[model samples]
Target: MTACIDTLDTPAAVVDVTRMQRNIQRMQAQADRLGVRLRPHVKTSKCAAVVEAQIAAGAQGITVSTLKEAQAFFQQGITDILYAVAMAPGKLTQALALRRAGCGLAIITDSVAGAKAITEFGRAQSESFEVFIEIDSDHHRSGVRSDDPVLVEIARILHTGGAVLKGVMTHAGESYSLNTLEALQAIAELERSECVKAAEAIRAAGLPCPEVSVGSTPTALSAVRLEGVTELRAGVYVFFDLVMHNVGVCRLDELALSVLTTVIGHQAEKGWIITDSGWMAMSRDRGTQSQASDYGYGLVCNSAGELIEGLQLRSANQEHGVASFEKGQNVDIEQRFPIGTRLRVLPNHACATGAQYSAYEALDERGEARQWPRHNGW
Candidate 1:
């Protein structure tokens, strides 16, 4: 049977196809304008259809956080893949298996021990794995500091120890904390300069450093120049959530992913509209809490994917989401949203929300929904 969103089950993951395609084009255009290849991080959608659309829109390759994603996409005929996370010793066997099967799976590391492990594993397996040294551009997460002497030491380890040292890459994840253009741009420049500095240090030490990759959705959209960067990488821009909206990179209307839920009941006296979607359905991500606007669990939208202003998911239990207005606002919840009313909730974090579901009901312009399966787990 041909399915429509109106007939689908509640608490389902839904994607607005048109908006998603537009998002893909926007990010691809940003990469083009900066004169760098867009290696979109697939950790956002983790769906083949979405990745295929990204590649069709001029993305050169893909970035993944896990070898499972690498294997999944590689089986879909994508050969060029970068496992962007710092490599753990336990996962080397799976990474090697992928490379041996003809997948151009490049792994990364930020420590001397990690570098030695990769090189030793490569030598034992008679393989030269492509490797990138992760740089901690924003000091928000893992990576060697761009100025740290260990930067060159790690690079030299890979180059002289049998691994193909691809280059340097960094993610300015701290960009998520800013909302203004000035701050975003400043962090973007910082991200670019710091990553490039690390690459220069490597080359100054007489090592071959070809690629300088840097990005995060906010930084990628705000970067004014990529003078030393050969590639850009970003993940969550594809299904922008409330977090990205509050970060000022995307508008409320551009959000492509939402949770389709049903208004199962109401608390008229308390003026609350209860829904079937809870943290279990939305994955408990309160990413918008520190932003300029805090949508409790999420912002409430109509089933058609339009925000119903003044309303948000105020609280959530395991399977119950309570929707109410901002403090001081008064509205008749029962009359406005009665039993069996189908509604949508825009999440605070797209990646976390997406991880809750196994597949997406992609809604096209004509109101038809088709299933697009996504993978979960490590």
Candidate 2:
């Protein structure tokens, strides 16, 4: 018999098919409205089914955080893959293998050393590896500053050393910390301008910089215009978690992913409901901690995925989740959430939570579910 969330084992990763499709369409529409290609970051779901849905919605290519994702997706017939992280010298062979195998796999780097390493390896193997210079648009993570001369130098290294200098890319990851629309727009613009500036700088230096990419979920959704950007890349937006909601990029109802668990026990005197899902399942992401509202590990929800206001997974152990009513709710907890009571918990970081599972129990609107496998490691 086909399984549903209710019939699945506890601590399973569940994706609401309806909500997920909505999210996919929303992001694709946003990209269309902005007149840019959407290269979705597959690192969020790391599942073939999820990535296929994104491509079906008009996404051009995919951005990946690890070469493992590149390899996995490539095996699935996805050729246009961008390895968004800085290229590690040791992984050049693996990257080369993908390219030689007909994968249009692009790699990125931010430092002179990384650039030289990629160029040297490409030259040695007679492979003009496609490369993008990482731009530090928000000073949030990896990338060279748009104004920094190193930007031009890195481009030169790739071009002169027989590598394809594809363009420049930046991720305004810090946008996650902002909740206001104004702040989000400002950072989005900053992300756009800086990344464009980098691309322009490389072109000005007589380099063929064709693509300019920038985004983060909040920034992508907030940006009013992307005048010079060629493409936008975002990950967590696929299955937004509490963090994206707190960032004002998505509504709580838009979160397509959740961890399905069961009330295994209870601490009636303390008003705590013990569950089978712990840090292992939900991940250690307390992403909403510094936001306006802290959602301990995650917010509590009924089995149907409806939010249970004022309740959160307050604490967790290796195998147990301690859920409690946010102070002063003097209700009979034992009678409310007795043993064997099934529940779903929304995650703070969808990517992290999804990593804890190898496959998702894709729950459809009709309540039927099927397994969609996802890859992990490195």
Candidate 3:
């Protein structure tokens, strides 16, 4: 553990190792207490080292948004992967390749059309592909409704076609829109119960349904209990971005990821400090929008990662970011952060910010930077 950020280049993605491990342990403990396996989503960091830390901390398997993630982690010796998104027909060949290569990869589907496609492809390949049906607990995104008649239809299509119906999975993404614990817990329970009900429905029809999965970091952490959930999945909880902060899951100090930037210049009269890090580094993701507080681009912090009072990253261009004191707030921007001064900006979205970089300068307990590789694209 070393103690210095100046040794690393500016505008680099940095991880606080201590905080990240703490976060992993916390989530693992919650999953243990709830009696469910924690399949952490690797989409948040997209870094092998970070995912290994999670696995070492008791994450059973991993939930991935794309096949690229599935492939990347599989190469890292992690075979048990769940491609959580509805599998596109075009990707069946890729999934088959992984399954053939000894990767215990599972795919998900929500529509009968998708299920039929998987069924036909599996039959042609003589493969009993493992599949999980997506459940729409909060109706936020794609999934079959818990009580939808089509739920049984899709189950039959897969089971009859020699595909193994692994069970149902749901993500309470709407839980992110909530700030209070009461609402979050309600959504968590709703997510759990609805998914279990869907699985029960499938089993009652004589189809084999073994796993019932549910998640979303807020829901996973806020859940009062996990009655029938076989596993839980969440991504951003590893880094805990501004969106999660607004959702009341983590505190500012607990955030483990940040962008190390430098002050190259300043717009004096406008009270703006021009940063070398801009939209490119921050990924043009305004996730904090519509929340109780709108952090224009991101929250500004000093060289030590502490919040700069009344200061925020108000605007950003391709290669430049403008930081200023909030309206009616007074601060000498030029004098406070002059040219050549380095600082770290806490991003509004960790997943997006982390994606902007090819590698991370993971900070040790003493604040020293260590290079850790990461994968991106698709």
Give the Å shift of residue 308 in candidate 3. 1.3
Instruction: Quantify how close model 2 is to the true structure by its C-alpha RMSD in Å.
Output: 0.8
Q: For residue 331, what is the lDDT in candidate 1?
A: 80
lDDT of 2 by residue, 1-378 (tens): 989877899899999999999999998999999999999999999999999999999999999988889999999999999999999999999999999999999999999999999999988999999999999998897899999998898899999999999999999989988989999999999999999988889889899999999988889899899999999999998899999998888899999999999999987888889999999989998999899988999988999999998889999898899999978988788898889999899999999999999999999999999999988997
Cα lDDT tens digits for candidate 3, 95-139: 999999999999999999999999999999998899999999998
**TM-score to true structure, per model:** 0.99, 0.99, 0.98
Go through the candidates in order and give the clash count of each.
0, 0, 3
Among these predicted structures, which one has the highest lDDT? 1
RMSD of each: 0.9, 0.8, 1.4
lDDT rank order: 1, 2, 3
Off by over 4 Å in 3: 1-4
**Which residues of candidate 2, in runs, are more than 4 Å off?**
none
Candidate lDDT values, in order = 0.93, 0.93, 0.91
266-359 per-residue lDDT for model 1 (tens digits):
9887888989999998988999988899888998888888789789998999999999987688787888788999999999999999999999
Model 1: residues >4 Å from true position, as ranges? none
